[model samples]
Target: MSEEEHQHPTSHYVKIWAILLVLLAVSVTGPMLEIQWVTLLTAFGIAGVKAYMVAVKFMHIDQTPRFVTYLVTTTLVFMLLFFAGTAPDVMKDHGTNWEKPAWIAAEAAYAAGEVSHEPEHH
Candidate 1:
């Protein structure tokens, strides 16, 4: 690739940096704003923008081959799928639902006094 194709002006980098910093500030203060959906949306949205900037500017993903772009998109899709599949368990209240076999076993052991409430010494 020519130097011209590979090189970005300092001003471009500065602009992207400034945008990322503003997004970072928004993400940091999002939770304190006391709106759960707004906080989550802002955090995730800003994170996506930051990731896109890093990929396009730092990693040069936008100049990459079409196959490479497809590969990256596929990887991101799979990651979203993995997170979605596990989100229910992560968000669920384990204390209220002891349906898992491990939880049931632990409860049984506690009832039988096989599991001690006190801490063990070395």
Candidate 2:
């Protein structure tokens, strides 16, 4: 029908916006703590929450037909598969008939403490 027919009160969307903002702040600040597990958790966890909120409240995806939900789920699954299939190749330092000498040099320098690209923990 119309926006008013499907939408919640203004305060409801505003509250969701405020929650998303707070989550954004948490995700941005979380990595600064430099704990690997905490960083991963906060990054992915807050991101998933924010994505769901935007989908349900702003996009009104939940109001759509059940088939739409299945479509979205399938799309996300394919995306995950695509990423998983490519990530190992992308992360490799060398590949068939190709090498990254400059990156290797940079890594060597960082390891030797000659070039300080990585932030020192103090």
Candidate 3:
């Protein structure tokens, strides 16, 4: 086999492992800092980096075909799009303080005791 096809050096893997360990430590200790936004951003940012490392190294996605890489990229893009599309609705307030229409009708009938077993003529 060609030298280019061979796996990366042991030192490279060790370096990646060390970096991942550091990222893990940061993520674990981030919340303890109590900085709120900084902690959350740091944790998520470190997690994304760790995930990318694992995908490239352990999963060997880096050595995969172009199509496989494109597929993964496309999937991530679609996931982001889905989240973005739903975010507005999720964050918006529709002002639904009033009772539901069906529930209101049912409550009115219940209060009037209109729910009888006898048939009602039009």
Candidate 4:
């Protein structure tokens, strides 16, 4: 097959770029509407669309073997799983055996309109 057979016209790329720019504009403006669901929709949903476009069009991942896509997807799942497994521990302020007194104090102070002290880590 010739290179021309695999090549798209410059106009095609320009059109794709224009659409991506429009999506970018929408995503950027989404947060300013001050709606939580709408903000998340544009931030994550439109970003996902932009990522798919870049991967399929620019990277030509569509032409790759199916397993490459599977690998990427599996990796993403594992990353999410790791975050899920660790996030609770990371976010907790206290437990039965241990506590975060400094952080808790600092947060309470800040909330009550007092000067906040930095938490000490050991």
Candidate 2 lDDT, 4-23, residue by residue in tens: 77768889889999999999
- Report the lDDT of model 2 for residue 87: 89
Worst 10 residues of 3 by lDDT: 91-100
Worst 10 residues of 4 by lDDT: 113-122
Q: Which stretches of candidate 2 lie over 4 Å from their true place?
A: 1-5, 117-122
Better of 2 and 3 by lDDT: 2
lDDT of 2 at 57: 80
Best by TM-score: 2
lDDT score for residue 73 of model 1 = 93
* Candidate 1 collision pairs: none
**Model 2 TM-score relative to the real fold:** 0.81
In order, the Cα lDDT scores of the candidates are 0.83, 0.87, 0.80, 0.85
Can you rank all candidates by TM-score, best first?
Answer: 2, 4, 1, 3
Q: How would you encode candidate 1's per-residue C-alpha lDDT over 1-122 as one tens digit per residue?
A: 98697778899889988988998999999977869898887888879889999998878787777899999999999999999998878655364545567776777888998888655621
**Model 1 local distance difference test score:** 0.83
RMSD of candidate 1 to true structure, Å = 7.9
Which residue pairs clash within candidate 3? none
